[model samples]
Every structure is written in structure tokens, then in C-alpha cells.
Target: MRTSKHLIEQLASDLGYEYISDLHRPQLLPEIQILISSYDSQSYSLKEWKDAVQYITGSSCKLCECEEIKQYLLSLKNS
Candidate 1:
């Protein structure tokens, strides 16, 4: 099955993540907010956030995970 952005957005909503795809820099701060909300009520460190991006995007390098002009679909288990 093909997972389009809209499908991802619906999945994100169902998964408790705030979908915000229109970003040029992929701000860590806002992304952190989604991370915090998507997961359980907990504090998210920069390292954990980086790891989350890696896990979600399936990228080896952290840089590859953080795409500047692309909006990605992410899910956090027990978050």
C-alpha cells in the first residue's frame, strides 16, 4: 500500500501527533512539541529526538533524517 502524505496525516492524528508538513527548516523546537505530544507526557531530549527522527525516517545518518524541504510521517511507540 502507498502511504501518501494525507494518509500519513490521518495516521499521525490517530497516533496523537500534530501534523505540520509545511516547513523549510524543519525546526527542532516545533518538531519537539509534536514529539512531546505524540509520545506520552514526558520530557524529550535532543538526542532522543534525533534518534526518533532516525527511527521514523529509517535513515542511518541523522542528517538524512532531517529533511529540510520534506515532511515525513512519524510514529512513536508508548510515547
Candidate 2:
């Protein structure tokens, strides 16, 4: 079984995020919220969000370099 750490790294690579574990998940919201916002900026769309969560949870490995994923990690650095 792949460890969570390895899974996160795979997720980052697949999504084009240079680093996913560096940013701390905000305590104010559930970790899933970060995943959701990381994938959708304008509206509530669960496509990318669900894919990422499924990757992290060891359910699937569907990876894509969507604009939303790029912006999400970039926003973390900018902030």
C-alpha cells in the first residue's frame, strides 16, 4: 500500500503542483474545503475536487493539469 506521503507527492506531480504538503491546511476550514477551493475558484464544481480527494484517499489516480489546480497552488505562494 502506498503511504499518504507518497500519495500526496503523486497527486502534486499529476496536478502540476510543485509542492502540495508545504502549505498548511487552514484550521478554519475542513481540509476538503482547501481541496475544493484549490480546484474551483469561481463556482462550486466538484470535478477536480473529487478527483484530487480520491487520489489522496487511495481510491483513484486520475490526474490532470487543469487551470484551477495551477492557480490554487500559485495563490498559496502569492498569499
Q: Which candidate is the best by lDDT?
A: 2
Model 2, 3-75: lDDT tens digits are: 3344345445544568765323343124433453443333323354435444434344343444554344334
Q: Model 2, stretches more than 4 Å misplaced? A: 1-44, 60-79
Candidate 1 is scored at a TM of 0.27
lDDT of 1 by residue, 1-79 (tens): 2223332343345545575342223433355446334442123333444554554444533433223212332332322
Clash numbers, per candidate: 2, 0
User: How well does model 2 score by local distance difference test?
Assistant: 0.42
Worst 10 residues of 2 by lDDT: 22-31
Q: What's the lDDT for residue 77 in model 1?
A: 30
Error of 2 at 3 (Å): 29
